[model samples]
Target chain A: MAKRAAFDIPDGAYVNLGIGIPELVAKYVPEGREVVYHTENGLLGMGPSPADGEGDPELINAGKRQITAVPGASYFHHADSFVMIRGGHIDICVLGAMQVSETGDLANWSTGSPDAIPAVGGAMDLVAGANAIRVVTQHCTRDGQPKLVEACSYPLTGAGVVKRVYTDLAVVDISGDGFQLVELAPGIDFEHVRDLTAAELRPLPN
Target chain B: MIDKELPTAAEAVADVFDGATVMIGGFGEAGSPIELIHALIDQGASGLTVVNNNAGSGEVGLAALLKSGRVSKLICSYPRTAGSRVFPDLYRSGRIELELVPQGTLSERIRAGGAGIPAFFTPTAVGTPLQDGKETRTFDGRDYVMEHGLTADFALVKCSRADRHGNLVYNKTARNFGPVMATAATTTIVQASEIVDIGVLDPEAVVTPGIFVSRVVGVAEPALESELVARGVSYP
Candidate 1:
């Protein structure tokens, strides 16, 4: 049971997506469910992308790229958007990851560099506000080092923020015990995934 | 002279016209423009379309405006959720508008607006729901689409330090939207936690040079409450 499926979309939930990888969730959001898309930029009720020459320059999502407004959509001060997030209105925040600790701490911002570009952005607010947080990323670095670590080496973006881990190679759940093997990627088995992971792997129930 | 009395962010904004678009700069919670927002509340400015990155939580930034039922439209990335007390109420009542954009594109639009470019070209929005309804053209076998620059009648910003002449110096994390927005607004108003001497500020450290700022005001930590807390400060 590989947890990383390209088509597993959440339903009718308001989601705040972090940059880079999480934005892909919009493309796979489930049908027949009223999943209201939110951007930290102060927009709600946003729809899927529109056809060329049909897009309004003024309309866009939190990522700051142009997007279409949903039929019932509305707007507010940029600060108000954070109110919604920090105030606990968001259900899930799908974030990309630099590293994930066994205790679910997210260290996505700095590599100890003063010049890191992303700067944790809205992640701090999302971590505090969102009831559930999911991470989408590759399991390892370019040099074949595992990103799922025993303890994050970088400054943390959010403490204990992650609930589920969906990587290209495996799906690991974070708990007090450790990285529980919830599922494995297709063409790979538990043994192979465990060998590549930095943290201890917990076997899923048969 | 130090003044203790003031209005609120919602009260000030209620007086603004129904369709007024405002530009607010801040990356996230770090650099949110809140002072002018407080004044807008006192003025009762309303029916506004605000542009910025992410709104603030209840007591700290744009969240106060959302709670007050003032802003009618938003051009930003983050949206209010079900648990967000006031924002959800507003959303449920059908009184708000939300827009989401790519973070890079949002910054670029403000920067483009500041630079006087009518619109810029980028491939950032090609495939996602972000690309719908935009114009696209090709250059050298590469496709580039147009995303319009952003501007506003009023710009509200917070500075770590400011001079009497209106130059601004912001610390790290807080520089997100201030500098570019300084150029996009017709009359930019700035609030500094500490107003500094004219010559004391190093010219190199000034993110927004004085020419871009129109008004300078100083506030203590409490004035920040309205910008931060949706319940707002007591005086307003």
Candidate 2:
């Protein structure tokens, strides 16, 4: 999933990776190319995670995990980091989503669960601010429930912000005619994709 | 010799009355003013509305402050972390109130408050639940929600170094909300790890100028739970 998402990131682009699965994209960023990672906690030019026992308690990412900074890295206030995001200074923001509608709406912060605590974090700001966005998630829930749907039943993080979705089963793009399948996983066919998706899927062009 | 340094942390925050809005700087445990927070707890001020990045973590610092039941409301972005259980328990049990703001919005609001800007618009939370009932307008085509500038009666910050004039510098990512929060409050109190001479700190290296800071208290041993653990001190 990280390798697939990395292909979409252009060199010298300022990118913000959301927590969870989306953060894996940083490890897969093509070697020798500059992809500046912005953490909403206020560090830019973020480097890879530190090795065990070498972690600095003070050096952390927005996800509250220990990380390292690359050469010439800079830090700023949390507000300025968002200004970089909301002002469209960030080129790409890869995030994890709980649900993606056929029309490209995103719902990732909350599942509308009554007993669960809702933590918005920086998802809202990143979604609304990025010039382009890509969502990475599992195709279905543990119980075989599809995440991609006709419309999000859960609360939305943003409206019409997701452009591409990288799931376990396939890579799809939000299109006028619903989810258009771009590439299928090896050995998986259209029938398998259709069976797992709750939303209508448009077949790949011949 | 203008000495802005106070003798004690308690003395630095002595004037903080009840029902005052205070901005506490920190992102997780990095730059948390744990010593100052302990002083606030000891001073026994109540009904405070705290503006911060995270609510608090574990059973010390901000978490301990929240657990004291003295804080009436929390104005923060991310209130939940791995070790954060105090605010959740208090909030669920009707002991505390929360005003959840996006991390960026929270930063900008405090910054604007200090910079004399009343309010501004952005597209961060236009269609989400956070934007509900907020004044929004169309600018150049897209929708933007109006967020007001946030200021506090006092700001408690943690710094790595400070001169007698109150000019401060921070350590690494620990700088988090310190710079912005310093300007957004009426009385900005700092807990510095080391107090240097005025000219010792280069002007170009200062992240927050002395003009915004009202008081600086020198702390020989800044109390940080993470640092304690890193030094092999078992927390109580």
Best by TM-score: 2
Looking at model 1, give its docking quality level.
Answer: incorrect
Model 1 alpha-carbon drift over 4 Å, by segment: A1-206, B1-18, B80-83, B222-236
lDDT of 2 by residue, A83-142 (tens): 899889999999988899998999998887866655788888888989998999999988
> Model 2 shows how many backbone clashes?
0
Give the best candidate by DockQ: 2
TM-score for each candidate, following the candidate numbering: 0.53, 0.96
lDDT per residue (tens digit) for residues B49-167 in model 1: 88876655553457666666678877775553222355555655667766655555666677678779889776544433455689988889755568899888877787778877888
**For candidate 1, what is the lDDT?**
0.67
Residue lDDT tens for model 1, A1-206: 11232245466778777777787777665466567878776577767666987864335555545567777876543435655775678887788888998888877655856332222346655765667888898988888988898888876765666888899888888987778988777788888888888888889887
Reference A-B contact fraction recovered by candidate 2: 0.68
| Interface RMSD (Å), every candidate | 14.4, 1.1
TM-score for predicted model 1 compared with the true structure: 0.53
Error of 1 at A112 (Å): 36
